[model samples]
Target: MRLSTVILPFRRWHDGGADQWRRAEELGFHTAYTYDHLSWRSFRDGPWFGAIPTLTAAAGITRKLRLGTLVTSPNFRHPVTLAKELITLDDVSGGRVTLGIGAGGTGFDATALRRPEEEAWTPRERADRFGEFVPLLDRLLSQDTVTYEGTFYSAGGAQNVPGCVQRPRIPFAVAATGPRGLRLAARHGQAWVTTGDPKLFETGTPQQSWEAIRAQTEKLAKACADVGREGDGPERILLTGFTPDRPLESFEAFVDFAGRHAELGFDELVLHAPIPDSPFAADQRVFERIATEGVAALGG
Candidate 1:
């Protein structure tokens, strides 16, 4: 299992922000991702930087580490604008960028820009929008000029000159568990992402979480089969921290945790970088040790 990490966008660049990304590369992480939010939960009141800018800066400092958002959604983004930014970011990173995208949840992002009279999108509406969003974003990134119209979004002769540094655009790591979302991932993703089932987070056992993910992979395989890509689906990525398993408690724990997920067919495992005084908080030393030694232990 390849090891990766998510570094929450809670720090300012001048105040040791760049150092964390630089250190991520030094520690040999495959990719260092961040939350793509205007402001995330709990950290809403705290400093949260823009994902594109943070990634551009990280690209400037790191030579080999891949950079990406854990998942950017259509919550507050238009496909045209987001595609332009991603193309620039891909060039900045020298093609070392991945776009982990999802159909956003009903968080502050859902209503952050809405007027008082405007209601947030319902689950059905969110799903409908995502179905349109991903395909259009795909076209906008891969094609030179796109002119299309849809219920939730549109493009009017939008132009992306010279396109992405990564041919056919940067790799998309689509985050999904639902059938329609999985279908999208199977059709368009270079990687499929999951955090297990959030419903099981509170009361479910770790064994149950593993089973849930196993079921998800099965669904993904079925989705790929439907699209005539059976046995050659996107790479599977499990973003840890939402589930009950505490993989980073120690090097041994991470190895065991990663090994089990590997058995479930996950190609990569992502742990959150240690955060102080938060739910994601963990011992920094342990996190570093895992980054340095955990992958070798897992024979990554």
Candidate 2:
């Protein structure tokens, strides 16, 4: 299985930020992704940079490291504008950009744009909007000119002149677990991502978390079948850290962690790059060792 890392956008490009991207490339990570949010939880008051710009900058600095968002959502984005930015980013990266996208959560981002008096989107509404969002995005990225009118978004002959460097736009790594979202992923995703089950994050054991991921992957397979997709559908990705597993505690630990998930049909595994003082905190040394040696340990 391929190993990757999620580098949070909490540092400025010039202020020791570029180093992380450079180091990720040096460490031989398959891809380096960042959270695409205006402001994420906990890091809300801290120095959080924009995803596209950070990725654009990383693309310039790193030659082989693939760059992308852990997820960009429709919560505060429109397909037309997002597609435009992604097109430019793909060109800048020389087609090494994967747009990890999702239906978005009801966290700070859900209400960041709305007034206190205005209510946030209900669960059903969010799902309904996402249903419109992904396909519209798929079209906007693939076609040169699109004029789409949907319930949550409308594109008025939006022009994407030369289109993306990756042929049919950049690859999309869709993060989803629900039925509609899974169906959307099955249809549109080049890769499907999961952080296991959020419900299992704080309360469930590691074995339970693995089982939850197994079930979700089965659901994704069923979704792909529903869409008439033959063979293994989208690439499976399991983003580590959120689940109650200490994958990065040691190199051996990561090997064990990766071995189990790889058996669950995951094509790639993503670890959060060490953050100094947070839930994602880990020994930087161990992390680097895992990046360099852990994957090979799982093999002969």
Candidate 3:
């Protein structure tokens, strides 16, 4: 099983991204990821950085820690431009990039471009849009040149110059909460991630969240089977923190949460690095403890 963490980019303004990710790699994290939002609601009032650029800079600093977005959606950018950026990131990282994506939320990300309210997307429309978007991205990355004309997006002679360092492109870590989204993950994901019931997190009950993950995994397994993929088709990634309601509050809680996810059939787990609010050394101490005593407690 693999273990990873999400570095909240807004929090890294003080320490800088390079130090944050390198610490994760040096501490034995398999992957390091950042939340991909144009403006996360919590930090909407203040400074925030772009997810792709933060990850690109992280790629330059770290050697082994696989880097990616927690979940990038087709809310603002076209698939063509995203494909080019992702492939270049793959090359720059020596193929250590994983593209985690999903059907976008209807928050600032959707309205950031100021599209018409009548054109505001329903859940079903978002699903349909996602279904179209992922396959096109798949084609854009794998093929040398792509010419696609779909209901949601179109591309003409879109060149994937030099292609990806990872043949057939970087692995996709697709996140899904609904059936339509689950099937998309089954169809194209190299790794699968879920945070369980978003509603359940409002109450911060770890047990309930774990149950949601278990149920989702069963459905995901069937999604794979329907498509003739094996039971363990994609690496299952579970996100535990990155939210105020549900966090790794204590060392014991962190170890317990991670182990149970492994028991529930998830192959990988992700936690949120503490927001840098306290003294710098104190904030880092939290990470150091998680990497050392916390990881050691997970058993080798």
Q: What is the C-alpha local distance difference test score of each model? A: 0.92, 0.92, 0.81
Give the lDDT of residue 186 in candidate 1.
97
lDDT of 1 by residue, 95-165 (tens): 99999999998878999999999999998888899999999999999999999988889899999999999
In Å, residue 218's CA in model 1 sits off its true spot by: 0.4
**Candidate 3, which ten residues in sequence have the lowest lDDT sum?**
276-285
What is the lDDT, from 0 to 100, of the residue 44 in candidate 2?
Answer: 84
In candidate 3, position 266 carries an lDDT of 81
Per-residue lDDT of model 2, residues 1-300, tens digit only: 899999998888888899999999999999999999989888888888899999999999999999999899989999999999999999999999999999888888899899999888988898899999999999999999999888779999999988999987788899999999999999999999999988988899999999999999999999999999888999999889889899988888888899999899899999999998898999999999999997789882
| Predicted candidate 1, C-alpha RMSD | 0.9
List per-candidate RMSD values in Å.
0.9, 0.9, 2.8
In TM-score terms, candidate 2 sits at 0.98
Q: What TM-score would you give candidate 1 relative to the actual structure?
A: 0.98
How well does model 2 score by local distance difference test?
0.92
> Which residue pairs collide, candidate 2?
none
For candidate 3, write residues 1-300 as lDDT tens digits. 677888867745446656788888888888898988988876777677899889888888888889999889988878999999999899889999999898888878888887476465788888889999999999999999999899999999999988999987889999997888888889899988887787775665666677777899999998999888875788898876522223355666667667777787788878677675521112556556777676568775
